[model samples]
Target: MKTVLFPVLISSALVLTACGGDDSPSKAPAPEVISQPTVAVKVAAAEPVSALERGEQIYKRCKACHTVNEGGRNRVGPNLWDIVGRDAAAVEDFAYSQAMEESGVVWTEENLSTYLLKPSAFVPGGRMAFAGLRDEYDRDAVIAYLKAQSPAAQ
Candidate 1:
């Protein structure tokens, strides 16, 4: 019995030592962090289309209702030959909404961007049925296209 007890105590002592029996609050070892590789991944930046080109794509949507030629006639909407600096509802012989006529908005690039984003919001009760161009880039492209074709541009 004594011999058996001696071996058991030795076994327990060895296990306790092996398993870190020290009750004194010992700080854990700090973890090692590996540094990243020096080589960086490269990406090809997309070539952006000229504003006129991009706006042409956007204007396709407007062409059904408006024309951009210098002496074009009005369709469902007014001809937009010199629309850039024109006052709202200023197109002669074209009917404009009361809200638009009274809104007093000049078609500056900034104003056009805002109006094209959401026309009804810009001019409530206006007759432009197209919901709006939601993309800022698209609005900018469209405005650029209009600028390129304005009477000044001609």
Candidate 2:
């Protein structure tokens, strides 16, 4: 019994010696980082459309219903001579749908592109009887052509 007690005490002592103390130093509190408020930025306006080199090709579809030459008579729809920047449904000597007249929208590049893509969607109940141009590039080209024909743009 004495021999067994001696060995148990030695083992316990060896285990206590093997257990290490904490060696790391105390750390300072970290500073808090405050985030700044986000601001909305304004971008510069887009550049104006240049000459209609590709527009002639795109205008093939539009030519069925619109004429670009000044003094050209209205076809199924009003003549689109100098259409850009013109008041909506303001073609003289031609009857216009109430939907188009009431839209009160001016024909800008953005507006014209949207209108050309889906005329019925742009001006609900308007009477531009043809299906819309689906391609964005083609719409851009058509807008360029209309801009070229505008009196102010000239």
Judged by TM-score, which candidate is best? Answer: 1
Q: Which residue window of length 10 is worst by lDDT in model 1?
A: 22-31
Candidate 1: residue 65 lDDT (0-100): 99
lDDT of 1 by residue, 14-120 (tens): 98876677788756566688898899879999997898899989999999999999889999999998888889888888998889889989998899999999988
Compose the digit string of candidate 2's lDDT tens values, residues 1-154. Answer: 9999999999998876555334655353566889999998999987765448668777887788778888898988888888888898888788999898889999988999899888899999988776888988878877887777767766
Cα lDDT computed for each candidate against the true fold: 0.89, 0.82
Model 2 quality (TM-score): 0.63
Q: Cα miss at 100, model 2 (Å)? A: 0.5
* Model 2 clashing-pair count: 0
Runs in model 2 lying further than 4 Å from the true structure: 1-51, 152-154
Model 1 root-mean-square deviation: 6.0
